[model samples]
Target: MKQIHHILILPDRVVVDDQPVTITTQGADIVTELYRRYMNDYPKFFKMDLLSRLGLVAADILLQTEGAERGAERDDRAVVIVNRHASLNNDRAYEATIQPDNYFPSPSLFVYTLPNVVAGEIAIRNHYLGETACYIAAQEDVEPLIASTFNEHTTSVIGGWLDVTDEKEFIAKLSIWTH
Candidate 1:
């Protein structure tokens, strides 16, 4: 069994240790709002998809609350997350770019169709430089993701659920755990 410290990132809020941190402001899009309000300093965040943004915000708060430094060089950590929609929102956006109206398929949008891109983003942001993955499952499950850590040289794991169906639909439950 894994002893874990967790955080929940909802559509319009960010919660750590069962306490909402008031991370978002009054806006139509919470992801954008949260990014602007809490993590606007990271320029790369503007280029990411909605799912990645949610994951980033959640991880940002979770790491901060857990006293983990993002810039610190650490390769012993791993990111293991599960999601439901799994980049479908970006897929739909990419699909629209190739339509008859404007037949220019955007490479930027095309690159984000992969669900693991969010994991990669999180890894890059935090400098984990270790095992990182995003599992596409029917529902949120920690077993497979957590189990992967056991096989790797991972000393700690950032594991959880990150699901984004569209702009307005998403949820992330993340945890920081040590083995």
Candidate 2:
């Protein structure tokens, strides 16, 4: 993980070159809804409703757009970081799933339980075909998260947090690093 090409900060609703990309909520938010939006927008590319499927779906999209930034080439080594704490707001589901004895949860909510779903989404969307990992924290902690994932051949990293509570507030910073 030597090359961090560019770090993009998408705060709230932002238009990147006239394209609409917004972080509307935070904390226990319905991440699936966001997934649906992506599906709707890129119908030709993505068609998924489950978290696992969404992970791969997102990864495919990432490979094409963000992955192309470096040299119009694809690097499966690229990593992605999803800020789960800030983006998840479904406290009810969180509590139910985390119950001591409740191992089997509503399959829908269970998929989002792991923080790495974000990376999964990106990998699925882009078909990155790289090592994928996820981290969970109350706040943003980039050092350890990035360090652990960084490798000598790593070209760049798509890292950030997404939160969706009552309203919706999240930030995903896709940074491109180089050594």
Candidate 3:
């Protein structure tokens, strides 16, 4: 049977295994706070889009709480992420850079225009080399899409709904599922 460990991150709080772990300050950015608290060693985190940052932080909490390996390649692990917006926040930023008056397209923002980049960021951070996929679907349809990524070679998975909007509203309900 597959055992799943869960973590949910919101702008106001963070929960792990159904218990509240952190109550974020009212105006502070939860992603930045989480990065400062858990990912100070990883400087690259500062450059990622909000979606990637949210996903990575959620995965970090889930994996750390579950005592999973970090900083080592793990071929048995996979990453799957689902969202409704599909990187629209970064896409808007990237679009702004290419506007007619200010035609300076940022390569950094451009890379994050795809939702799959969130999954890639999570995989790269944890050295998970198995399948990495992102799906754009309604919240109700997320389960089957995530389940489809599992296979015989995959022993564990980090996946769930990760969505962010231009106004910085976000939610990351991530899980670590182990066989």
TM-score of each: 0.88, 0.53, 0.93
Off by over 4 Å in 2: 1-12, 15-75, 82-88, 94-105, 137-140
Model 2 lDDT per residue over 63-140, tens place = 344545533335546555555463244445656776778755667565565656656666555566767766666445
Regions of model 3 farther than 4 Å from truth: 1-3
User: Best-fitting candidate, measured by lDDT?
Assistant: 3
Q: What would the per-residue lDDT of candidate 1 be over residues 104-129, giving only the tens digit for each residue? A: 99999998999998888899888778
Cα RMSD (Å) per model? 2.1, 6.4, 1.6
Ranking according to TM-score, highest score first: 3, 1, 2
lDDT (Cα) of model 1: 0.78
Candidate 3 Cα deviation (angstroms), residue 130: 0.5
Residue-pair clashes, model 3: 0
Model 3, span 8-119: residue lDDT tens:
8877778889898765563227778887887778898989988988888888878788874568787888898888899998898899999999999999999999999988
lDDT score, candidate 1, position 82: 89
